[model samples]
Target: MKRTAAALAALSAIVLTSGLVPQAKAEEKKPYKIYLSNNFVGNDWRQQMLRIADTVVKKAPLAGRVDLKVENVETTTQAQINSLNNIIRTKPDAILIDVGSPTALNPTIEKACAAGILVITFDQVATADCAYKVESDWSMLPAVQAEWIAEKIGGKGKVFVDRGLAGAPISEQLQSGFEKVLKNYPGIEIVGYFNGNYALGPEQEGVASLLAAHPQVDAILTQGYGSGAIKALQDAGRPLVPVAGGGYNTASLVCAQTEGAQCILETNPAYLSAEALKLAVDILDGKEAKEKHVFVYGPFLSTDPQPSKLYPDVKMQKIEVGTNAFPDLAPGLSLPITPDWVEITPQEAAGS
Candidate 1:
């Protein structure tokens, strides 16, 4: 009897230990599957954005936690929708979209949300209520820049405005913001408007044509690279005027190097993709976001630095060579290249 009791106790101990091992295995969290659906890859910004997303998944904290897949589609809303439908069928844990159209992707995004897939639209975001949005505070960029331009030119001048890419939601928003700020200063006149199309060639051509027509232009508001506007001014033999443009490496460098240039550059950073990925991982890990829409703000880089009355909260950094402006890097490299949490070097961000 004593021997049998001892054997039964030993068997119980083994059973208990075996049961605990599977319980611990069951508690181990599996890596979540995440997909990035990029609508356009034609421009340098889009390329860099995609690169940043790819880099994030391979780095610490996110490396072992996410299985990221990127799907670049034709620059059409329908193409993205079709691709998203296919991705939905695969049932990924999350989907991040740099949407082509804001309203057109609502239904598809809703479908994904219904299927329990977290949908996050960054950069050019969608209007789907169910999906979360991660974007630069678009309203702040134009408002502050326009204010700077207004102040720089003594609250009045003939300003040229770049309408940005045609039919893009961000373009419309930026245009509206510019107009809204400039309206307060009755002396400021928007002498000319052109579609920069968010490219160097188009921006240069458009600005050059505008400069020819409006010889007395005082300032320029560019939605993309400011370098194009500076080049246009130089080509036309027009003196460099105070210009507000996007935060591109070339834009800051050109603005800093040009003898008479007075410029302010603001960024919608490409690290937004990485931020979206991080948000997705957080959600998947059961950390509920306090708000559905998350706005990531980048720095305001300027040649003549001053506090913004409109957006005082926004950080304004002096555009210094080798700091914000990299002379050695590619022209189209976006500014504020590295996010605070990640250490993405200039070469990596430039895709060198």
Candidate 2:
């Protein structure tokens, strides 16, 4: 699995020289083959992430130079490991995967690395030493959310914790971070904990059932189903409470419109898949990456006047503050990616 530095340096020179020379003088460039392996397509966020991965290769720099393939299977370690082994057999120049387990797929990933294939993992990553990882600040975001919720409720209240899908690395990290912060605020009582699964329908149903039994909740801390929590409260004929949520845009917009209902939005964008694609392409082209791991932080948006400097281009439809919430969009819409990060155009988004 280990690549000799001298061999890598020689290949780097060839790639750089090929790019610099005139088309007529340059050697005929063969299209670099890449494969994307997704563990599941359970939610809207997953669907969007796959779309962005497919769309990125059809654009500039990679347009005519890369042949990309995509595959999805059940979210199981064995399933993903099988997929990785098969992809390695195909001998693609690179493979990008959203893994199902942190350590289960490491040995398989090493096999691919030993075959001289560049591997990059995003979303949920493998523990392979050879693979590069690209993801957001999973730890900081949830901790920030927990701290904000505690402060909003005066450090003491009955709070409902809406967790994401079980067994997911990101979900575990977010939950751990949230729990760590809650420990500091002993006055804040966690009345109930439920897994929303990060989808709208299931989340709404779970919140509804919880509301029926415990209607006196003061605040709700949701992983990625804020809109569902809002709808659950509305259906129960109960007033809205201060909630920390992410992913969906409608909940934040609705919160802005409703009087005295405080909300904060921080979504992990699907476009990060495109960034993963870019990183893979760069490495295959023999461009040495400065860092093996990259951490992108999701921008925070709230109903209050947020820091104007962080998100300069972010235009809010109702609150007139931060990014992530758009009232102009229909209900159940995911937060739109920044124009600078558009791998797919508006036409593709509409068609998808």
Best by TM-score: 1
Q: Clashing residue pairs, candidate 2?
A: none
Question: TM-score for all predictions?
Answer: 0.93, 0.85
Q: In candidate 1, which residue ranges exceed 4 Å CA deviation?
A: 1-28
lDDT of 2 by residue, 170-200 (tens): 8888888778888888898888888988887
Give the candidate number with the greatest lDDT. 1
Provide backbone clash counts, one per model.
0, 0
Model 2 segments more than 4 A misplaced: 1-28, 305-324, 327-333, 339-343, 350-352
- What local lDDT score does residue 26 receive in model 1, on the 0 to 100 scale? 60
lDDT for every model?
0.91, 0.77
The residue pairs found clashing in candidate 1 are none
- In candidate 2, position 41 carries an lDDT of 88
